[model samples]
Target: MISEKERNVFEGMAIPQILLSYNNGKIKIELVSDSFCNMTEIDRDSIQNNVAELVHPDDLASLSVCFLKFVEEHSNLDVMFRVLDKKRNCYILIHGTGLWQLMEDGTEMILFYFDDTRRIQNSIRHIYSCLKEKDPKAEYNDAVTGLPNLKYMRRFADEKLNSFGACITQQVLIYIGVKSMRSYNDRYGYDKGDALMLLIAKTIKEEFPSSFCGRAVEDHFVIMDEFYGYENVINKINSINQKIKKNAYGITEGIRAGAYVVNPEIKAMNAFDHVRQALKDIGKDMNVICRFYSDERDGELLTERHIIESFEEAMEKKMIRVFYHPIICTKTLKIYAIEALARWIDPLRGMISPGEFIPVLSRYHLLYKLDLYMVEQVCREFEVRKKSGLPLIPVTVNISAQDFDYVDVPEKLRKILEKYGIDSDNIIVEITEQDIAKGTDSFKKQLCSIRENGYRLWIDDFGSGYSSLNVLGQYDIDRIKFDMAFLRHIDDNNGKNRRIMKAIVNMCRELEIHTLAEGVETESQLEFLQEIECELAQGFYFSYPKPIEETKKC
Candidate 1:
């Protein structure tokens, strides 16, 4: 047993302390400090000699092992367990450290100091809060919006998903991205941009109420909550956008959201990926507000992943081949220029459609590589045709807006042409009208440099977007390729499209910008192009895009 002085010393300490005595194989509680009783809300009379009763039931086995080890090794006890708070009917995590003394009467005395883990955690949180206040860009929270960020969302998602197996309630993971946010930031200032983000974050929290909300990235927010139904979630998103528009100081761009219902097959992070995929399905159309994940979209996402993974290998093996679709001079019925198109012939999947892979690459900004590769291949074909004495027509290779960001387009094309000992006239640069409509200074400079370097520029997919007339007036384009939509809807609306097509061709002719009508399939379409005096035409009515060798024959 502990002597009177030692017992008084242990009890007088400010920290919660307990004294126990061991004799033979049994344990006995000798004394308890006032602090220990106050912390645990257990009276000394209530505990009596049964101190083990105060330990949590779940912690009893671990506590026994800790005690046994301490006694056997004559080591200081340092262990963590839960102490039952009888008054509160709860358990508190406690870190207990003790030193054992061999008593004079063949008894062992143990003195323990207990620290409440909750108190320590609270102190740590206080320090962290001070630090976060000093530095806005703290971990786990977005500096701009003061909301939990992607890292925090990931951890929260894991915890929620771990508990989902036992619960029947289905949760929805939502990803929302503000459309035209960059333009908004450019028009307003970055401070206003940050304010916009904060407003959206606060709005999302208010709208979802019970959901876990976070900033996924710039102008994008994520939310997870119990999914009542699609209508409920969509209405909430609409409400969020309406609130944002009203409060955002004349912000015009609305938020687009994608939702995924949580399922057992996917992990936590993948839920975000699925919702992002659903958002991508909405594309650039500002009218769409919300989209939900579907199995078809998931399959497309898988295909996109496969395409991204296999792109480098495909390029190495030259599986990404250039097929030339011949554009014909309508008057002479002869090939005027061949538009170089990428055709990925996977050994396993055979031919993959451009519709499947082009947008995927464009989304990921991988189109620059494919575009440059197409240019190089076209130059090589020029070389082959020269060596074989086959007729070489100028080849128009499509360039995406992303290509200019990746490389100096004019310089890159100059080097590729020089590499093949080919002239710039042998290759024409085709940029979509929509891309030209972006009209970034750098993009405009690149286009000017291309033309100044003797490479012709053709505006592809003209009249596809709203900025067709504006594009023609601003840029010095060599040719205008009408978008297929006009031809597809030619006879609709009592020949309204036919009249528009005729007027556009007439305008192009007057501007000295040569015109081409693509997707000309039937005899009527060809006759319409001929009647409108369209300078060039290309579509299935002539020939499909064929390999370089087959194109030479045409």
Candidate 2:
């Protein structure tokens, strides 16, 4: 039992604390601090002997579990729960840390340090004050669209989920991401952007009248509604998109949605996360406007998360290695150039496919790190080849559209070359036709700057997108690598694909822009490329992408 001096010291402390004695699975609050009474505005008489009555009913099970776990393991207890504040007529979030000991009287005593600092933080106070100044409902409503904000939506969903036992109902969370909103804002203005957002908000509200809607963030909206089958929800989303397009003041951008069926077993916020994961999986594919979350997608999301989290460590530990795929001369069967591909061999997960991690990194705008690392590794490989008396050939490193946004590609590449004492001529910069289609002035300037710094420019995956011909006319590129799709479908349409491929190669040859046909896996393919006078060919016919050490032997 706590002595009179110990009890006095605990009661006199400023930090909110509670002393509880557990006997026969029943807990009795033995003592409470003045700070606890002041913070919660609860009288000592109400909770001093009955602490369970003060805890939120919804959180009681979790609190009981925490105590039970502590009792079994004799471990420090940490839990977050809501406590009733009688004066405010609301519950305050509390983080409690408790230590337990066996008292001399055979009772288990637990001293819990309660922290409600989140309620009194300056940031929370400032937000509340600012919102109150704006309007009476400012805390719950978004200022621009007059729709419920994210906080309000979360609370609404939580309340609905919390009452699931009383009224069990199937529900779904939908995340709508506004496409091309940034470009729209740039084209118009912020006022016009706000107007566009208001139009979308109004459309969603009208389409799903009974649903709880909110503006999650800039250009993102969320909805929680009764599950009314997948087809019904998809059709409603289509209607919303159509209505917004018609009324959006010449804004052609549409919304992409991801939906998740709400599981009462999960927290309200996690439902939002799952829905966003579905949306992220949709990516930039125009064909997929709506995607539903599934167990497989969730597993993929977890894997992507692991890849992202492990990237920096992978780089530091030299797990990301550069592999070279030789681009061969179609006529002489000699190596003309080699494409540097990044291969990640995680020690724990083993070989992680580029198909898996590359897209994840690209989506997260982390390709710049990988691209830069590849450049440095290529320079180091050049040094290695020189030392080994091996032939030096141009190494092509791919730069993603996202890379230019994160770093000055030309400047960084120049430095990496200088650091390894390698000439820029030995390195080639490759970009996709789809990247050129973006036509951003900054990207265009970056491309020019790259060539000006003495690195050869090549366009990879030509003919994969519609802008291939247009890109050739606009940019002064040294080489155009035909996309593997063209070769993959060469026999399609009764020789139409072969005719198109031949014409493109011949046109490039006439224009003095060198041409390379990739994915040439057969002698027939190679003979066709040689017939068209294509300058180079690269595929398994010559060599698969191999480790640097293995490539030296080739």
Model 2: per-residue Cα lDDT at residue 61: 83
Query: Which residue runs does candidate 2 get wrong by more than 4 Å?
Result: 1-156, 165-170, 174-228, 235-258, 276-291, 401-406, 437-449, 452-454, 473-475
**Measured by TM-score, how close is model 1 to the native structure?**
0.60
- lDDT of model 1, residue 429: 86
Give me the candidate number with maximum lDDT.
2
Worst 10 residues of 1 by lDDT: 182-191
lDDT of 2 at 29: 81
Task: Show model 1 residue runs off by greater than 4 Å.
Answer: 1-163, 167-228, 232-258, 275-290, 386-389, 552-554
Question: Per-residue lDDT for 207 in model 1?
Answer: 93
Q: How many residue pairs clash in each candidate?
A: 0, 0
Best by TM-score: 2
Tens digits of per-residue lDDT for model 2, 151-213: 787668778655542445688889999998866754444556789999999899999998878
